[model samples]
Target: MKQLVFGTLPSRSTDQATVTMGDASESSQHELKGQLLELSQLVEPAEVLHAYAEDYISNTQTWSTAKDKKPRLVLRPTTIESLCRVIKYLHDTGLDYKVRSQGFGSASATDVLISLSAFDDFEFYKEEEYVILGAGGNWRGYYDRMEAAALDWSIVPARTPSIGIGGSTLCSGFSWLSSQYGCVSDPANLLDAHVITTDGRAFWAAEVDPDLMWALRGTETGFAIVTHFKFRARPFPENGKLWAGPILIPRTKVAEVAKGIMSMAEKDKQGEMSDRVAMFLYVMRKELLAFIGATQDMLVVHAYDARGEAAGREEFRWALEMEGAVDQTRGDMTMGEVGRLQEHIGELRGTAEAYWAPICLTGEDEISEDIIKKSFGWWTSMLDEPSSIANYGYLLYELFSCKDNLTGRHSSAWPRPVGYKHMLLLGAGCAPNETKEISDAAKRSIMRGPEAILGKTMKEVDIVPNCIEDYHDVERIYGSHFEKLRQVKTRVDPGDRLRGWIKPSRHESG
Candidate 1:
């Protein structure tokens, strides 16, 4: 292998492995191993993994069971140039590879994998009110950085701190400020990006390829790999904190809570709710639900706002006044404080298989009482199932309004949020071996209510930016932009090396 220098790290040490090709086909596996080893030497900080290799186990261990794939070669690229070299080599060799960033739903099996954990670079331009970050870091890192610097600004990051910046941003990121400033990936918030096409060409996305930039804002895994992103940050509230907490309602008042949710969403649509405020309704399991103590199940209304606690009460008046209020807590809290306060959700911690399938709704349908009731029943029923208890399967409502004041400077591949009011992210987790069964069961329950009401499968649902699951109807997920995105994919990767990242239509191009 030729020693190449480009990224910050040099090379990783690997222990000898007992090469069992498994289903990789002995001949092809040996050839791929050789090809990857040669390419690995050409890129700084690159590691080529064979099955049973220690590095391969460590690298693939990060993958969620929802789509955990066992690749023949896992390439962990530490720098921008290193990643570019890997892409170029893979494209030239016509070897299929899947790009992984924090490996959320990337469990599909593959022989070649490219990981971006080493590309984490976070920089803040205090005067410019922007942050330049590599694709690898998570929201928690950015928040911690800002806290350390005492910087009073933030960008749109995922609600959870573990989601990678690259995947979140490119997939139309949702943030607390989304309603105010548009999706984080909106051209207005995203200043620019550095990307490498699957063909191995690296350049500034904005300067060299506008269409590619547009396609990336809302799509997953088709066009190219983003190494860095420049994001326009929003100022923190005056107190340097936001007021957030959950408002609990017992089962006795489920109808009232449902009505309040509908009213709040309607008010949001009319531009009545302050953009600073975001809320969602979720049903907790009997264990957590019992805390509020309403003999039957209960719903928890989670809300956040830039305003202080006193104002929060007035803002969430309807929800607060709803009969059967069990318990509530709202206070001004810093990002770091909130992070710590957030319960250490077992499923999100990646201790189990986590699969997310979201359903989106819009217009009057967004407030459908019947849908909410049915969805709640289905969710509660699922929680009562023995598998649900064993697997820690659950779901939640991600209710928030889409920003209407979009600049549209560049086309966003994300489904247009014209009439969409909010979404529901159905999350499920289980032992690795039980992931598929639990995920399917969760979907079955979710479809009975959310899907049936919205008349959209997970494929057609437009929700938050997340790791792509191994579902077959991604074209429906990409919607109107799938064709254009396919064209961009063809332009960037005519060989279709990155096709594994997403499911392909029968006639779709690379």
Candidate 2:
């Protein structure tokens, strides 16, 4: 690995003393290491180790191999006090640092990485109908706990059980329950949060500052570090069961399935379908589906109805009645069981370099079958590319009834005011040894697939903040809320010490 040079660091003794990375002597590097080690002693149970330490690899693994940037040092802070001290020291000394919860997305620290894995605390107040979740824990553990307790209620969480609660909530998390409860970051679900500011001031955002609280919800950028979340729990349906599973169709029925999905979207818009129903349509190759006993490449409709099998069958009548469709619906399943359906796929994370490009369509826009066919055509063409480095790729369409299910639309920093009813996510993974040029070319092709879907109505598309790329325009992603978020970011973190998925500096010129 190449030696990383992080601009410069000021001396601990005086503000005037500075050491540049390029010119620094061995003594300077030792002095910096000594300072980092002091943090562990300052707070009990905290530990600081060099990046090459044996435990470092296990502590800092992420879902995407592309995010594996090794830092100079790793800091594991066990308590809130330790985290505050670490943050304050980094801010005061003008050091570059990054925070990691689950290391799922693009989280990397060039100088120091603060690992929050020790903050795994969970508490549920049944009488009050709310739950407190630690930032370090993932949704899988939470769901397991809920099942162990045999509780009659549960909170809304991301679809993938491996996703971290803190990172997902901060990025406006979407779930199977979203059609009924909206995103996990919405005010109705995410009541309050325990956060630490850039200067190490710890407080509950909702109690102390409305501006901070608003910014924390869906900004997906550097505002504050949230340690825990307080979410309101919803009553589980009677028997704690719902209808959900995959309905497989051969690739030859691509046009028919696409038309069926569009028809369902129209019914949702007309307020004719139940809000409890949601569907995901995806294209997968035969090789990927072999584990499920499938003999051919397939287009799958993963359907859900919070109401039982009877209602689900009624809601998805068109798809079920279609010719050559295989119904693999689990008669009725608990939320935990529903989540486990995708666990096999989630296990593929970190196996290769991955990329995502997403496009969202609002309720006002009309989606024609022609547009869907063109998008599918683009995806299929890439699978046939002889020299393509994208060994595994899939195109997914997420459909939901948004208008009637969501509440408090203006409460969060999410830019889409009217809310989006349809989302198309294009994902691809390549070998880790692939060249940057080849990987970038594959990403560009994936990005163009969405454009083919939008056709001449491209301007009407909305952006899903969690699925955005570095090349995407900030103005379009944030929409009209860009300036307000910038002001809030500038006020809270004037120096921009913290890093987020979308940096505020990207919009400075606009």
Candidate 3:
């Protein structure tokens, strides 16, 4: 029998361009082999894979801020059938896979991946007010279309034009519009999804399959691979005013700030004003920045911002007063303008290859003051410690809401019923230079965090809700439906194909 994989550089393709491996004295080579045999559909030839591989390595790669992981294999299938075929091939080979609908940016957390960038299929039916999109299609395209049509809709729109809509909405998806429109999930987001299971069966998910539907929307790519999404969009207020700013509240007042915000949320419920929306709360590095998107102009912010004069002084003053960051004030800006101001924040956390060991315990609660204080202390200490001039930055918080709006729960492949999660995100630049001290400091800061904030009032210092940690819980949570989904995977790609490189549900439970 012939070896499935031949020697490296097995050339095959349409157009030809010869390039030299300039540096090495002699060309290097390795045998090429993969589970291409298990797939039941036509696939890009080995030569195509080799050529694509050559080009992919030569240029860019995809990932979110999630560190230490790069797609072990990046597959760009041209269609639904082709994607399933490739996934089937990978499954039979026992490779773990993660799906990235957008170009992997700073927030991603997987190594082996599938890129839908090549699949640019877009079907827009005018009357439906919705569109079916290939996962890889750029999100900015959709927003621009809506903006052009004068359509005011709010789903999970990416804060960055470059981010992928699928990944953003599916996991911890948040936006400037989150407060007003809720999150990025709802019955509306339940339209339909084209998914490839571990067993490599391509299928659609919706309310029709409630368990699978929920899993697809919330969990990461553990249940199945999502290649297409039917999103929910409706006309909304286009000329909405955006009241956003960074209120430089002293770090010592973090607890007081939390209390004040909680109080405001409670008051808003008790007929404070007519407008409705969830509030934005991000405990950033130096300031606790909060803002909301409103259709109403001349809307009062909170009390008054003592900050000096700015263009939109009235609006800025209102937001500052409400925020109570009063030590000093930064002027308010429109929503679009705010994006520009905050853009630098994204680059502040370490780098692309650094990882933030999540400061979370499975099945724990983070509702105490001590937990908050200690957590902050650990992080602050690490930031102060003598270390590389460049170390991973840490972001800490767990969003608590009643679960409504377009952005529902933090949509991860892993969703626990537990409450008050903390994500100790690590950021770095050079993958190789990210040191152990940096990673350890990040981790140390997290586990001890609860003592800072929760104190004794909190029940447990639990794990973040957005990660696939233990397999048993996954089975328990999904119950019979999970088995059924597994069966579908088994039946479709019987060879046990696409194992790790995007398995059906095998990690912890894949």
Candidate 3 yields a Cα-based lDDT of 0.43
Residues 238-357 of candidate 2: C-alpha lDDT, one tens digit per residue = 545789999988888888887787787678668797878888888777887787787888888899998889888988887888887889998668888887777665576567777776
Q: 258 in model 1: Cα distance from truth in Å?
A: 0.8
The C-alpha stretches of model 1 lying farther than 4 A from their native spots are: 1-20, 43-59, 62-64, 107-109, 238-240, 288-298, 321-330, 339-355, 384-393, 428-431, 435-443, 446-451, 455-473, 500-510
**lDDT scores for all predictions?**
0.64, 0.72, 0.43
Query: Candidate 2 — which residues are off by over 4 angstroms?
Result: 1-35, 39-46, 49-58, 238-240, 364-366, 401-405, 417-419, 456-460, 501-510
Over the stretch 384-485, how does candidate 3's per-residue lDDT look in tens digits? 645542344454442223234333333323333332222333222224444766545544544444445445212233332233332114454333445554
Winning candidate number (lDDT): 2
Global CA lDDT computed for model 2: 0.72
In Å, residue 394's CA in model 1 sits off its true spot by 2.7
> Residue 434 lDDT in model 3?
46
TM-score, every prediction: 0.85, 0.88, 0.64
Check candidate 1 and list the clashing pairs.
Answer: 67-107, 68-107, 72-111
Decreasing lDDT order of the candidates: 2, 1, 3
lDDT of 1 by residue, 1-510 (tens): 111223564553444422224476766777867775666566543255555555555456554554565665667776666677677777777555678765244523355677776677777777777778778776777778877875567776556566667777766777767766777788878878788887678777888888878877877666778878888766776665678877777766777877777777677758787777777677665565555454755678887777777777787888778777754564858865554444344135436665566665656755577777766665555557667433455657767745643775236777655655477666555555665556576545544544654665555565554545554256666667767776776667666666644323344432
Q: Distance (Å) between predicted and true CA of 365, model 2?
A: 4.0
lDDT of candidate 2 at residue 384, scale 0 to 100: 69
**What lDDT score is found at residue 23 in candidate 3?**
30
